[model samples]
Target: MVQFRKDNILDRLVIVNDSSSEVEGEGNRDDHNVGTCIYCPGNEHLTKPAVLVLVQKEGIVRRLSDTEDNRIDDWCVRVVPSSNPLVSISANGTYSNKPFYSEPAYGYHYLLVASREHCRPSYIPAEQWSNVLVALQDRVKWLYMQKGVSYVAVYMDYDASSGWHPNLNIVTFPYMPPLIEQEVESINRYINEAGLCPICNIVSMEDKSPRHLVSIENFTALCPWAPTYPYEFWIVPKRHGIQLLRMTQKEIDELATMLRVMLGGLYTALGDVRFSMIVHASSEKSRKQLHWHIEVHPRLVDKHGLEDGFGVHFLSVSPEYAASKLSVASRRELAKLVGIT
Candidate 1:
């Protein structure tokens, strides 16, 4: 979280808090809310009731195919409402259109717990990751149909070194966000100038460039040329899909495999580095012109005054070098697994 100071113009800070103070029984180990791990299996009561659950059977993962009347105790992944939500669903879907630019923050906030155990993405199995993505796609499709929801933001902040849990936040907004708006404008401008989608062109160009890291059947990962942070990389689908909901089941499986490999590579290369994995998709207005992708920002360096004052970013290592290192690390890590290599 980047914060500004009213007292000093150049003063800025990145606040990194693992848990909220409002969480009930946050520190009591005997209450089953043990050690900041309310997302674990036994602590389901600590959070909202599970809206969705996926379970594994004989090495295959599937949604808990049980009647709503019967609840299940075993689940590989669970989706629940955030205890401290930034927004909530309103019955009337009403807003206060004031003169000073204000409105009601009414929307749904859900947390997709990827695992029953407390671990990072690097340690999660590929099957479980696939289940998480399937659940995410299902939830996003449902959230977009809500009364006041115009856009859904999906992101994960995994800083296991600081005891942060690995979970994805799905927050709906009543209107299009500013950053997404800016991205759509840029994509439109690029299409007009180049006669093609910039990201689709990037998928082709990066695969042939020195900054290329890995390429699966449906997706390819590369280090962006002008990254805002060090070791920043992007994973884009080879097929031109506008939203994650449009991905096929095979695509989701392939994506999970790529995530596990790339995240494992990062873990091997940089010991316990904190990172943010953000998904950028097309808004309702720009669905046809924009392509979806994932951006990874490894928190390896600090953001100083120069970065905050201006929107300029400085990188200590070049993307070509970073890609080469990650490529080697991925290969080395994959070799350790039985049948991966």
Candidate 2:
């Protein structure tokens, strides 16, 4: 955790406690509860019931089959909503708050109970990942065809390092969020004035709403410019999108493929790093903009002082060199990873 005592700003302090310990958090872990995490390879029956299942049979040409419609004894990937939530996010349908966060008595906050073995998304069998891709698209369509739906997103947070609290947070709010244009503009402004966000040159050069640059076919790595850590790295979607739940099965499949390769790349470059994945989307589908993207943060050091004291980060390596070293689809890295070889 980024040590809260020294340099963290008030808003950025996310007090994530150890879930496996005997210590209990103050708030209720049941109200928004969807079900058990069930991400580990063994406990399949303990999870929230699967609302949707996309399976892959051995003989299938292009693995795309819905098992949710029929009760299937055999299944590859399953989807279930969260039983309890830490940070509230919406997915699949929009709900209003009679108090706030409350919507039409029906909100969608499901989870994608990935396949059996406990590997990260990058390591999950390509076939299972493909099933998830198609299942997510089906979920989005299921919500869109229904009433009172506005937006959707496919999210997952891998926490084996955090005690295997593994699950995806698929959210659909009552409304859409603002596009990353504001983010881009603000980053651009910071770069223009102070030469900050130096890595943003990548964005400035192409300047497209949804850029199509891969991390490169061979290199699947990158370093962040305004990283909040010593050797913090970022895995961002090259396209400009906000709500990724709207993506098609093919798109989701591609996302899964790239993500798998990237994870493998990380392992190849870094010895053993703990990381997290986050997905954000544009509000109400944002036809005007694309807000689809993801971020991967490898926890290298216990961010004790720098981030806790000032918002400024003490990056230990150059982005270019880190990228080259990591040897992923992208070329970027920041601090502590090693010198920009």
Candidate 3:
């Protein structure tokens, strides 16, 4: 049985799956070969039937799904179940007690294919990115309405060497992640003591700071005061919104533009570096205290013992320097992409 096991004394949790050891050792050998790229268009049979497919014809976009016998061929974006899921919906809910406390790892894992083209540039076009976000919002809203779902985790893992197509992972969890829980607690504490949202205040304070990168219509991108990785930055909504579902159409477009410009800048500045993009938000119960944002962490350096074991991060480039380097490139890229200049 695949189960979530709580650390003996700490708040940490681990997914224990006894059967996955051998398969996990095989590594991502197939990920680097485009000839067998399952995510590429016309290879729908290589993956599970798509749950959501977005197709554009004559300037009109339609949302669709795939059945076992049919698959949409001209889809701009697609979402399907992960072939190797971390958790399963069919998990039996059995609980163990005391020092060996455990619960079934019950949830859904999905992969959102970002585009139709294979071997494309690091950053997709802004319009395509918007479609990706729209599909994501659709999936996340549906996931939240399901029974026993406490959180929906959205993130992307990209490495040039992996030869994998561009996609984002959507994972549903029955319980809140420890880091998110801590963030919610901290945000609530700050609100009670200061009578204002900490993120909103950060946006206001950093608007003109050296750490500021760029600001599009409804979003602003900036380097955090303390970063866990080199050249790490965050894209935050200017207003105090707690969920992506609350975003307006205009806000979504702006966010897509922000993503395109920032990612293009990262690629231009550092080439095809490995990175992770994570979306952090509050669950329904804690929405009032938390704000939603996206964080981009470039894995330029390896984590050492102090970082992995002691939770202490060492950064070579300061936020100010990183922002200064990224701002000029991103602005130029934005101008070329959307005529923002």
Candidate 4:
């Protein structure tokens, strides 16, 4: 049996496939292989030149980039162009309104090397996560300033079998993605009707609910009321914000702490499972109405025909149960990581 659930703000619907099945753990820690990996610290020549690099020297961090002849080996973080980019800068920006309306996929794509290590089961330290976020902010802000760029997408896919090196994908789009456009419309509708941001209300409401996982200084991690995947969770800011570029250093550090703690808790509770982390924010045009957030979706099962054909998600575990298990583990992890106990 299944129960249909609708998203709180969006018109999205999901089906709880089985409310009674136990949430089983699935993940394994794989050994690191640095010899053949290209993203490692010493193999900078295997990929394109880095667009941005952060190097720490004499207790001061310096921002540098790779030239055709030079590659900085001593770096904390690096951003390089994707070898197989999703979009190209030299693409023809032609558009036609014919039956098969199409335009060039004109944009940019880059890879963010989040760590010097090749592969690891554990999440990066909070301080290193802070550095990664700062680098991300720098790239996102720069991309938004370019003409014709409408959106910047940041996400990470981590799987043990895929040589899960700590890296993130940054892609730019000339137009708003359909899902984000829908969210913008929904957010504006809620603001007009309820006179408050829906995400702010959600944070306040879920702060004490069973779906609430953990709350760090300025950010909170919680399971959504209706999730598309088992054990899906989101990290959102307590205060309303539009873009990651505007985050202060303090806020970035706190957000990094929240990510480290929550992700560590996830691994502690569920082992080394595969997951995707996505950043959702409004484009420049709709920035005023949307509240940005980071969503983590653990890939626990495969999708079936009903989900693909009907646009309905089937979830094996309910958000309440997931929150119950994750909150306890995450809280303990947080205590150990930050001495909250």
Instruction: Name the candidate that leads on lDDT.
Output: 3
CA lDDT of 68 in candidate 1?
Answer: 49
Task: Rank the models by lDDT, top first.
Answer: 3, 4, 1, 2
lDDT of 2 by residue, 61-143 (tens): 23233332434436566665555432233222343332333223234667666655445555565455566667766777676
Report how far residue 137 has shifted in candidate 1, in Å: 0.7
Tens digits of lDDT, candidate 1, 252-300: 8888888888889899888688888998887553354568889999999
Question: In order, how many clashes per candidate?
Answer: 0, 59, 0, 0
Between which residue pairs do clashes occur in model 1?
A: none
Model 2 lDDT on a 0 to 1 scale: 0.48
Q: Model 1: what TM-score?
A: 0.84
lDDT of 1 at 28: 18
lDDT of 4 by residue, 115-189 (tens): 887564256988888889999999998999997689898888788665546888887877776678778899999
lDDT for residue 95 in candidate 1, whole number 0-100 = 33
Models 1 onward score TM values of 0.84, 0.60, 0.94, 0.87
**CA shift of 41, model 2, Å:** 7.4
Q: Higher-lDDT candidate among 1 and 4?
A: 4
Ranking by TM-score: 3, 4, 1, 2
Clashing pairs in 3: none
Task: RMSD for all candidates, in order, please.
Answer: 5.3, 9.1, 2.2, 8.7
Model 1 root-mean-square deviation: 5.3
